[model samples]
Target: MTQSMNHEETFENPIIPGFYPDPSICRVGEDYYLVTSTFHYFPGVPIFHSKDLVNWRQIGHVLDRPSQLNLDGTPSSRGIYAPTIRYHQGVFYMITTFVESKKGARRNFYVTAENPAGPWSDPNWLEDAPGIDPSLFFDDDGRVYMTANRVPPSGREYPKHMEIWLQELDIEKKQLIGPKYSLWDGALKQIHAQEAPHLYKIEGQYYLMIAEGGTGFTHSVTIARSESITGPYENCKMNPILTHRHLGRDYPITSVGHADIVQTQNGEWWIVCLATRPYGGEYRNLGRESFLVPFRWENGWPVVNPGKGIVEMTTKRPHLKSFPWPTRPACDHFDTPQLDMAWNFIRTPRDHFWSLTERPGHLRLRLKPERMTEICNPSFVGRRQQHMTFAARTMMVFDPQNEWETAGLVLLQDHDFQYRMESALHESKNIIRLIKREHGEEEVIATQEIAGQRLYLKVEAAGQDYHFYYARHAEEWQVLAEYMDGRLLSTDVAGGFVGAYIGLFASSQGHDSLNVADFDWFEYIGVPQQ
Candidate 1:
C-alpha cells in the first residue's frame, strides 16, 4: 500500500507508463499530485501521487462515481479528453472536457475535493465553455481564470485554425463572470489543433503554455507571455520548447506533447508530457504514456531538456528523496473484497454484470446480452498491456450451455478491433475458439476442443507478435494461436486514443442466458525480451 524511498541518482524517462496520457501536474507542499486522461474507460481520470517527482503511485481516480461521468455508449477515443489538476487554498480542483459523441459536442466541467485521495464533489459544469483540454489558473491577485481551446467567433480562416481563450471565473459561484478574450493561437499561424493551455503567473508576468500541431507526429509544446492576464501575449523565440517531430519517423518516442510543468519543493522545475513508444516500426501498442523531462525558465521563457532538448529514456533524478513504490503484484487472486485499482471497464457499466462475493475468492461475470463489438458496456474486465514483452493469463471455470454464449479472454484494441478467445460448445463438445474483429468484421483464427472441466487461457507478446496458449491441466500448455499479428491492435491501424489490453469477457451474443464465468485468478507479468 506504500512505496519505499530509493537512493538511486537516476530514473527512467516515463515515470509512469502504459496507456495513461495527457499528464497534468501540481505540487502541494512536498507531495506532488498528477492526473491523466482516460477516454472511453470507466472511473475516468486516474490521479497519481509522488514525493520525489520521479517515482509515483496511483492513489485513485478523479471521477469514480457513475453520477459524475456517463459514457454508456461512448466510442473509443471520444469520452474524456485532457485534464488539468490545480490546488488552491485548501481545496483541490480538476477541470477537463467530456467529449460527447452526439455531433461531437464537448462540455467543460470541474470537480473539487479537500483530499486528493478523494471523496470528490460532483462536477460544476461550465456553460458557454466550448472546445476541449480546459485548464484553471489561480492568480495571486485573488482572481481565478479558466483557459481552453475554441474557434474564433468569425470561424477559422484555415484548416485547424483553433484559438486559446481566457475568461475570469467566479471562485464562489463556480462560473465564468467576465468578458471572454481570445489569447494567442500559436507562433505558427497555421499550426493545426492548437490546444492544451496552462496559465502561470511567474516573475510579475503571466505565461501561457500550450500544446500545438495536433496530437500526432507533429505534436509540440509552445509558450507565450504577457504583462496582463488577458492581453497581447508575446511568443517565445523558441516557441516549441519541446517536440519529437523533427527527429523523423523512427524515434523511440513520438507524438510528444500535451505537457504540464511543475516546480518541486526543492525549487527544481520539471515537465510531465504524453508521448508514444512505437516499437517494431510505427506501431504503438503501448499508446500515449506519461514522461518526465527536465525544464527551466531561461530569459523569461521555458527551456525543456536544455542541452539535449529531447525526452530521454533515462536521466538524472530530482534533488528530493526518491519515493519508489513497492513492486505491484503481478497476479490478482480475487480474494480481496474489491477489484484492484489496476482494473478498468470499457465505458461505464449501467448495471451489475460482475461480482466478487458471489463465488468467494473468484471474480464472477454474468453472461450479458451486450457484446464488446458494440459501444455499450459489455460483460468484460481488463487491465492495460503495460510491457511490450508481457504475458496475461487467467484460470477460469466456464462451460457454454449453448452456442450463443462465449466466455474467456480477449486481446482488445477497441470495440471494433480485437482478438477474442472464448469457450463454447461445438457439436455438443467443449471447445475454445480464437476470433479476430477488425473494422467491424470478425474472422475465426483457430478452434480446438478443450479437455477437463476447467480452462486456462493465456496470451504472450514478444514485441509485436502475440501468441495465444491454453491449458486444460496445471502447467500443461498448448498453442492455440502463435505469432498472431499485434499491429492490428495499434492506434496506427485501429485509430483510437487507447492502447491494447488483456481482459476477461463473457457475452451472450444477443441471446438471453443464465451463465457465469468464474475466474479463479488472473495474472499479468512483463519481462525483458530474450
Candidate 2:
C-alpha cells in the first residue's frame, strides 16, 4: 500500500470540480472512466477518463446527438437525473432517467457503446424500468441485473418513501425480464429518498451501496450485503460508510454522498462522489463537485478516509503513478471548429442558430425570437462558473437596429434568477444595460449609452458578490453594476439542482430579426481565494 505523500505531491479534493455531480465511475484495466449528471444541458452526461484517479480529462459526452437527448421545453433542473456507467463484456452501458420531458413524462433508458468516448447508441428506452439512478451489474455467471430506486408496490407510508429494486436484464434484447425483487429499503428506518444504488460482488458476498438522507445537508452513503444477489440483504453495523452531514454546516465540504467506487490495477481502492465547497457562510455557487477519497477494508466493510471518517479538502495521492492532464485554455478565441467540451447550451440547440466558422475567429449567434428566460432553446452558449471568485469577460460586436434584439454576457442560474448585461438599441440609441431578474420580476439596475460597436463586458465575482463592467477599449473598464448579490444565482435561492453559468447570449424578444452578434473572444480567470 502507498503511504501518505508530502503536501507538495498531494492531490486536491474535488478532483473534477465545478457542477460535475452524481459521479459514477468504472475501471477497465489501467484506465478509469467517469460520468456526471447534466440536467437540461444538451450533449448530456460528460464522460471523463483518468489514469491515476487523481488527474482526469473529459474525453466526451455520451449523449452528443440531439436525437439521443431530447430536452425541449424541459425545466432548467428537471431533465436528466443521475446516470450510472458500467463496463460489461467489452461494451459500456450508461443507464439514466429522464424526468419531466417536454410533454411532462418521465422515462428510463440505457445506451451502449463499444468505446467510452463518442458515437454512443441512441437511447434504448426501458419501458418497464421504473425509477431513477438505474445501474447495471453483470454477475460472475454472466447474468445481468438492473438496480434502481422506486416506490414500493405496497404503497408509501410517507412522502419520498423509496426502496431499491433489482430485476434481470437481457442485454441482447435490451429489456428487463423476470420478477422484480426488493433488495433493501435503506440503512436507516423511515429514511426517505434512498437512491443511487450500485451493487458489487467481492469475496463471495454481494454488497449493495446506496445514497440516503436526500441530496442536501443530510446526504450520506450507506452499505448493505447479502449472500445472494437477490436476497434479504443485511445493513452494515457501521452504516453510512461515508458522509459529511454530521460534521455541521460550518464544515468546508458539505453534501457529500452519491459515491461510486473502483479498485485500481495495483489493488488500491478509491471513491469518487459529489460534494460542495461553500463560500461566504454555507452558500455554494459552484454547486456539487466531484470529490475523491481513499478508503480501506476493515473486517469486511470499507472505512472511508480511514481515521478521519470525513471527506477532507485535500488527501494523499493515489498509489498509482501520477498522470497529469493538460488544463483547459483560460480563453477561447473561437478558432476551433467546434465548441470545447466546457461549453453547453440551455437545451437542444437549433442547428443554424450558432456557429464558429461563419466568421473566422468569432462565434456568431443569430438572433432568436425566444427570450433567455423562456423554456425553449435560446441562442445561448455558456460554461459553468467553477470558482467562487473569478472574472468572465467577452468581447462582442452587436449592431442592433431595433429594441427587440439584445446580445451580451449573462450569469444565468435559471429563467427567473439571472443577471444579464447586454448592449441593445433602446429609444433608437445604442445603450448598454444591466438587468437582474429575481423570482419572475425583472429590474434594470444600470444602463449606459455608447457609440462604439465593439464592447467588452465582464462580470467579476468576489465571495458571493458580483460586479458588472463594460469597456469601449480593451483596457478601460467602467463599472456598470456593483455589489450585486450573487446568492440570487445560487441553488438555494434559485431553487434548482444546477449551478451558475457564464456565457454569451442573444435574444430577439419575440420579434424576428436577421441581426447577429459576433463574439471576438471569451475569457474566464479564477481569482485566488483569501
Candidate 3:
C-alpha cells in the first residue's frame, strides 16, 4: 500500500476524491490535464493538471462563465453530466449534457480554451445534438468527428434501445456536418446503457471508447474499433475492456466509468477514469473519484487488462517514467482566485456561494437561501474525501449571540443524508451540538456547552459511517456520535446524480447580518499521516 496506515489495502487513497466523477484526461508535453463531470456545480467541468496522473492538482474550471454554466434554478444534478474532455492543436474542448429539469429539457454543450485554466469560451450548443455523452476526435486525415449515445427511436428492447452514433464535425462551424452512423453496442444485447464515447486513432484504424452499463456497481469501460471513422466498428474480442466487478463486492474501487486516455511524453498510454469505494459495499460517501490504469497494444488492438479483460487494483508495470509526478497541493492558504481541486458543492451554487476576499487567506462562504425541499446552499468549502477513515478538523469562532447563527463542520450527503455538528448560541453560552437528517427526519444526538472565543470541530467519515467529534477550551475531544448511516442521503435514493460530500458549512438560521463565523484553518489527514 502507498500509505501503511490505510487499512483498506489499496495502492493508495484516491488521487482526486469526493464527488469527482466522469473523469477525462489529456497529456500535453510533460504536463497532464484532467476534467470531470460537475453536475449542477457552478464553474462546471473542473480542470486539473499533474506531472504524474496519480498526483493531480486543480488548475481551474472550464465553464466559469454564466453562458457556459447555467445554474439559475437548475435542480441539483440536473445541469451537466458525463463530460468528455479532449485536447487538440492549441485548444482544449469538453462536451456535456445539460438536463434542465425532469421534464426532459436537455441539450449538449461544449466549451474550449487555449489553456486548461483560462478564459474558456461560452457554451456552444451542438445544433443537432440529440442524445448525450458527446466526444470529439481529430483524425489523421485532418478531419474532426463527433460520436455519442442516442436512444434510437426504433429500438424495441430495454438493452438495444441505446446505441452510439457518429458524425463528421466541422470545427469552424461548431456542429456536425456529416451523416450519423451507428457504432458498436456492447455485448450485442445486455449492454444497453452504453454512452460517453471517446475515440482514438492508432496505426490505420479508429478506436471508439465508451463507459457502458449503468454508473452504479454494474458500471464498466468498453471499446470498439473501425477501419474508417464511419464504417462498421468491431467490438474488442475481449470486451468490457476494464472493470473491477471480478474483484467481487469486497473490493475497494467501485462504479468505474467515464474514462479518458492520455499518452506520456515517452509515448506510453494510460487512462484516467472515475471510481467509487463503498465503506460497506453499499454507501459510497467519498463519491466517484479519478483512477489510473496502464495500457498497451496487442495484436493491433489496445488491451487494457490483458487476459482478464478487467482492471486490477494493483499493477507491476510502471508508467513510461518520463516526467516526475506533480506534487499534491495541501495546507492551502486560500489566497488564489480559485479553490483547490478538493472543493465541491452539494448542488449548483449562486454567485455569492463563496469568496476569499472577505477573509483574505481564509475562504469566506455566504449561506444562500435554502429551499425547504432542497439541500441548503450555505458557505461551504471542503477537500475531497480521499481516505475512508481520515479526520477533518477546523477551528472557527461563531459569534452573534443568536440561536439562529450556526457554523461548524459537516458530513454532508446531498439533501437527504446529511449530519450537521454545529456551534451555535445557546442561551448566553455557546453550545456545540451534533444533528442529523436521516430518512427525511432531523435528529439531534449530542449537545454541550463550551466557553471560548473560538471552537474546534471535527468530523470522521469512516467505514460506511459518519462520526462527529468536537472540543471546547482545549478539552479532550469527545465523540458525539458513531456509525451514522449516510447512504440514506444519496441522489440514488434522494433523487440526484451527486454523491455524499463531507465539508465545512456556516449559515444563519434567521435573517441577521451580524451572524458570522471566522474559520482559522481546515485540515484533512490521511492514513499516511499527512
Candidate 4:
C-alpha cells in the first residue's frame, strides 16, 4: 500500500470519518489492527492500523489481494458482512459471511494472513454454516471453534428464526469437525434481533459477545458467558453493555452494535464496533462505521455503557497504553496507488474506475454506468463514517467542454437519501450545483456557474441536519443548502444497514463517452459547538 506524505491535523472524534462499519480490532505487540465489513465494496474488508486507538491510520486493506476476496456481481448491499479479526500464533484471521443474491445462498468464509498489513490468503468456504456474522475462537488448548447465526429448522424466515450456533473447526482442513449445538436465540424472549457473534475466553470463562436490537438507533450490545464452550450460556444480568439511550429519536449516534473485543497491552478490555450518528437527526451519510468503547467486569459479568446506561458523545479514551508516539498523516492529497484506509466502496469497486496520481497529487475517478443500482455495479468506493458531526470537503476539476461528464462530492447512504454536489453542463455552460436523492429523483436543490473547470464542494453534517457548500475560487466559499432534514436520507426511511457517507463521485448516467473527475484533497472537520 502506498502511504501519503501530506501533513494534516487529525481530529479526535471522527478518528476516521467516512462510511466504515462492523469494526473488529486486535492488538499485536504494541500495535493495533482494526478491520470492518465491506458489504459489497469489493477490495473488501478495510484494515486500519493505529499505535494509539485515538489516532488511527489506514495502513492497507485485507481484501485488496484477489486471493483474499472476490465480488464480481455482488449487490450494493450484499457482499461482505460483519467480520471478526483474531490473531493466533502470529497469523491473523478474519471470519465473515457472504450473502449471495439468489435465495438460500448465504455462506460463511474465512481469510488468513501472517501479517496484519499484508497479502492475505484466499477465502475458504465453510459449509453447513447457513447464516451471517461468523466469528472464530482459538482456545488455549490449540482448539479452534466457530460461532455464528443459523436459520432455525422450524421457520424459514430470517431476523425471526436466526439462532447463534457453536461448532469446532479443523483449521488445517478448513472444515467443521463436530456437531453444531444451539447456543442462544435472538427472538427467544426479546424485541431486539441477534447477530454478530464474537467468542473468546477470559480467565477460564468462555465468553460470547453479540449485538442485537436491529443495528438501528435502538441497536445495543449484549453478552453471554458459559463454563464450557457449548453449554447453556447465561445472558448478562444487565444486558446491553453499551448504548446511547439518552438521545430520543434524532441524536447523532444511532444504529450502533455488531462488536468485537480485544485486550490491550495492559490487559485492559476494549471493543471496536459499528455505530452511526445523524447530522441533525436527519442524515447518516457515513453509514454505520466503527467506534471504540471501554469494557469493565463487575460481579463476574461484563459491563459497558455503565455510566447511567447511556453512550456519550465525548468519553475518556479506553484505559490502554499508547505507543507509536506520533500519529500518521490524516489529510490526503491523493498521491498514492492505493486509496487511504479511510476509503471504501458502497458496492464492489472496479480497479480501473479510480486512481490516485502522484505527479499532480489528485484522485482520478472514471465514470461508471449512470443510474446503476447500488446493488450490482462495482463503481462505488467510500470510507467509514466515524463521527456524529463533521465537515467533509473535496476539490475537483472536470471536463468543462464535455456535457457527458458529471463529477461531484456526495453525502451518500444506500440508494435513496443522499446529497450530491457535482459539476455538470448546464445550458452549454459548466455549472456547479447541489443535487439530492429525495423521493428517488435527482432534484436540483442549488446551483452556481463556475468561471473555470476547478471547484471545491463540501457537506457539513452536525447535530441532526446537513448543509452543502461550494467554492469556485479557493478563498471564497458559498453555502448551497443549509440544515436540510437528514432523515429523508436515513435507512429507517431509505432502507439499508448503512448511513450517509461524504466523498468524491463520478458518473455518466446517459452519456456517450466516459466522464472523468480529479480530486485534489479531502478533509473532515469535527463539528464544533455553536
Candidate 5:
C-alpha cells in the first residue's frame, strides 16, 4: 500500500505503532513532544520525542511513579484516557482524566515538568473540571483556558449527547474559575460521542477541533471557529476534516480521529491522530495507534490529508529534515538496574514482586497468591504486541513445588479474556500447558509433559493465526498450541478499549509461596509487511 514515487520522500502511517492512542502533540522550538493514553497500565502516558515527524524515540512516561497514578482496582480500558501535552513558557503540561469506575468517578488533572523526560510533578487535580478528554489552551494575554467533553445542560435528545465546554483556568491556583460556556455541539448532532476537544488560535481566530461519531468505525475529526475564545462558534461548511468511515469496512485503516495539530518552526503544519488497522475482518487486536497525516490551512479552515482526503496507509513525510535516532535492539537481557520504558506493570504494585539485582542478570518475579483472573496485581509485566507478524521468546527458570504454583507467558486482553501458557505441576507431573480463558470461561486446551525446569516459551503470530511453542533448551523446540483464535484478544470480542499485551506472569493461586521465576532474557522480533 506504500506507493512512493520518490522512496525517501514518503513515510508510512502509524509513526508509533501498537496500543498508543489519543495522540496529542506540541512542539517547543525545534523539539517536538507527543503523548498517548495508557489505560489500566501502570506508568501511564508515554512521551515520545521527534524532530522530523517521521521518526520518533520514546523519552519516558509522564506518570512513571506509583504516587503520580493510582490504578489499584481500575479495569482495562477504563483508567487513563486522552492525554494532551502542551508547553507554556518554561514548563510542559500534560492533562488527562483518570476514570475510577469502581467509585463511579472521573478525575481530571494536569502535571507539569521543566524537562519533559523526567521528574514530572504529582497530579494537580482540577476541582471544577467536570468531564473527560480535558485540554488546555494558553492565550497570548497570559491567560489559560480549559475545555472538555460533558453532557449537554439540557440533557440528551439523542444517544450520547455530549457537548464541549470551555472555562477559564487559573493556572496558579490549579483549578477552573469564572463562567463556563457550552461550545459547539459537534458537526453532526445526530451522530454523538463528541469528545477530544482541542482549542487552537490560527490566523487571529479561535479554532476548535474535536473528535465526533464515537471512537469506533464512525470516528472523525471536526472543526469550528469563533472570533472570541468564549463565544458561539460556527462549524466549518466542510466539517469532519478527516475520517475513513466512508471507505467501507475492508479498508486497511479505519476509525481515524481524535487528532491534535502542530505547526513546525519552518511554518509547516501536521497532525497526529489515532487510528486502527484491522487485518482480520473488523478485529483490531493492536488497538488504536498513533498515525500522522499531512495538514494545511485552506482559505479559512483546516484541511487534512490534502488531495488524498483520507488518512492513507502511506503518505508523504513531513518537510523537515530526515532525522533518525540510534536503533534499539529487539532483545532485553535484564541486565539494567531499572526496567525499560517499554515494559509496564498491570496496576499499582503495593508490594515489591519483581527485582533485577537480586540475581544480577535476571528479572525475578516472586510467585504471589494473586492470579490474573482477579483484579489484584499478580506478578506480571507486559508490553504491547506491536506487530501482526511477530515472534516473542523468553528463557526462564522456575520450580513448581505444587499444583497451586505456576509461571509462564500470558497473552492478555483483560482479566476475563486471556491465553495462558504456563509450566505447572499438573497431577505431580512437570507439564507445559496452554489454557484459554474466554469471556470468563476457563478451559485447558493442550498440555505437554516437559523435562527440567529451564524453559524457553515462545509465541508467534502470522496475521490472525497465533502459534505457541516451547523448548527445554535454546535450540530444541516443539509446538504447544497452534491456530488458536487470536480474535479472543481483540477489542471486539474482549469489549475493552486497550489492545492485547504479551506478559510474563507467576501465580500461586491462593497459597503463599516464597519461590520466584527468573527470566534471563526476552526478545521480540517482527517481520516487515509485504
Candidate 6:
C-alpha cells in the first residue's frame, strides 16, 4: 500500500511505538498497511495504515470478534505471537499463531479481509502447520507458499534446534498442498531458535530472512538466498544483516530482530522490526517497540542501516510523500458511542460488565467476582503507557457497598506486578488506598479516609519513580505515596513480553458485591523530557 505524500515532515524511529512489536508491512498500490502482535489482549493484531512508511494510524484490529481470537485463560504474553500481513490479489491476509491452545501446543491460523480496515473472516486454522511466526509469500506466477520455523525432521539434537520450512498453499481452498521443505536452520552456528522467517523473490532470486539468537539481548536478523523457491540456500557473506546485540546493554536500543521488508513506490527499501528502549539502567519497561531502518542492495544482497549497521533515533523519511494523520485524543471523556481503538481489555470481556451508554458521558463498570490479581478476565480496560514520564488521572465515583468491592486507577504490568490507587470500604469507612503487588506479594502502603465518594486518583511518572496522588477535587492533589520504584513494574522485573498499561479497574475481590464505579473521565498526558 502506498500513501499520498502531500507534505514534508521529519518522522522519528518507532513510527508505531509503545508495546507494538514484530511489525509486518505490505504495500498495495499507494497505500501501506502494517500489523503488530497483541499477545493476550482481545481484538488482536492492530492494523495500521500509512501513505508514507513513517506516519501510521491504527485503522482497526484484524481480530475484532471473540470468535476470531480466544484468549480466555491465557496469561499475559501467551496469546498471539508474531503475525505477517500480505495483500494478494484483492484480499488482505494475516497469518499468526495462538500460543494458548487447550491441546497444550501452539496453533496456527489465518484470516482474510477485502480491506485492511476489516470485518476479517473467521480463522482458517492451519491444522498441519507446526510452528510460530508464520508468513505467506505470493509469487509472480500465482503460486503461493507459507513459511515457518519448526523442529528438524531428523531429530532434536538440543532444545530450540529448529529449521525454516516452506509449503505450497492452495489459495482458493486455504489449505497446504505440496510437501513441506526444510529451508535454512540459521546463520550463526552457536545460535538456536531460528524464527520469524520472511521470503522475497527479487530480480529472479529467492531471498530468505530469519531472526536468530532468541528475542532478547542476543537477538539478530540473518539472511540467506537461493536460486529456487526452496533451498540449498546460501547464507549471506555478511550475515546478521541487522542487529544491536553486540553494542552492549547500555546502547539504549537493543534486542533488534523479527523484521519485515518493504519497497516503496519510489523504489526505496525499508524494514520494520522490534527493539527495546532501556531506561534508568538496562531495564526495558517499554517492552519491544516497532522501529524503522533504511536499507539498500549491494552485490545482490541487502545491507541494512548501511554506514552504521544500527538503528538510529532519527533517519531520513522514506522517499514517498508525507501525509500525516490525526492523533488519538489524550483524554477519553466517555462521550463517544464506542470505546476508542487505543483502549483494550485484558481478555474477552463479559458483554454487560462495562458500558459507556448506561450513564451518559460516564463509563460505568460493575463490580465482578474476580480481582485484578487473578488470571481470569477482570473488569479492566487500559491503554499502553507510551511515555516514560507522564501523568495519568481518573475521576471515580464509587461508594463500595461491601469491604470486598474496589474501583480505581492502576498501572498494570501483569497479575504479579502492579500498583493500584483505589477507593474501597476499609473498616466501614470510605477510604482511598495505595496498594502495591510485587512478585505476587500484596502490600498496602498508604490509606486515607475521604469525605466524599467522588475522588480523583493520579499517578505521576518521572524516570524510574512513580508517585501516587489523591484529591477530594481535581485542583488539590495530595501525594499518597511518593517515589515508588517504577522499575518494579518493568518487563525486566515483571518477566513478560508486555509493557505497563495505565487503566481503570473495578472488582469485587472474589465476592459478589453488586457494586458499581462510574468514571467521569480518564486523562493521560505526556511530560516532555527536560
Residue 506 Cα positional deviation in candidate 1, in Å, after optimal superposition: 0.6
The candidate maximizing lDDT is 5
TM accuracy, model 5: 0.98
For residues 1-530, what per-residue lDDT tens digits would candidate 6 score against the true structure?
54455334456777876899899999998899999999888779999999988889999999999889888899878899999999987999999999984346888889999989999999999879998999999999889999999988887676778899999999789889889999986555577889999999999999999999888888999999999998899999897889898899898789999999999888889999999888998777777899999899999999998898999887777867767898677889999999889899998775688899999999999888888998878998899887779989988898888888899998989988999999988788999999999999999999998887899989998888999999998779998999999998788998878888888999998887678899999999985433
Poorest stretch of ten by lDDT in candidate 1:
1-10
Error of 5 at 152 (Å): 1.1
Expressed as tens digits, the lDDT of each residue in 1-530 for candidate 4 is 21223233222344445567788888888788888777766567778888768667666777775455667666546778888888889899988888776453788988889977877888889978878888888888999999888666666454454678889999999999989988978634664467888888888998888887777777778888899889689888777777664467676566667877777776667667677756644556556767776677888787774654554456566544333445435568777776766676654444577777533688887877644324445344555445557777778887745665687877666565677777888888888887777756778888887778788887776655778888877757898889776676566577666555666778776554556778888877664432
lDDT of 5 by residue, 415-435 (tens): 999999999998889999999
Model 6, stretches more than 4 Å misplaced? 1-9, 101-103, 528-530
Residue 400 lDDT, candidate 2, scale 0-100: 92
In model 2, state the lDDT of residue 430.
97
Error at 381, model 4, angstroms = 5.0
Worst 10 residues of 4 by lDDT: 1-10
- Which residue runs does candidate 5 get wrong by more than 4 Å? 1-8
Comparing 1 and 3 on TM-score, the stronger one? 1
- Which of candidates 3 and 5 is the stronger one according to lDDT? 5
- Between 3 and 6, whose TM-score is larger? 6
Question: Model 1: per-residue lDDT, tens digit, 377-439?
Answer: 899999988889998999999978898889999988898889999898888988998998998
Tell me which residue pairs clash in candidate 3: 52-325, 417-489
* Higher-scoring candidate on lDDT, 1 or 5: 5
TM, every model? 0.97, 0.97, 0.88, 0.85, 0.98, 0.97
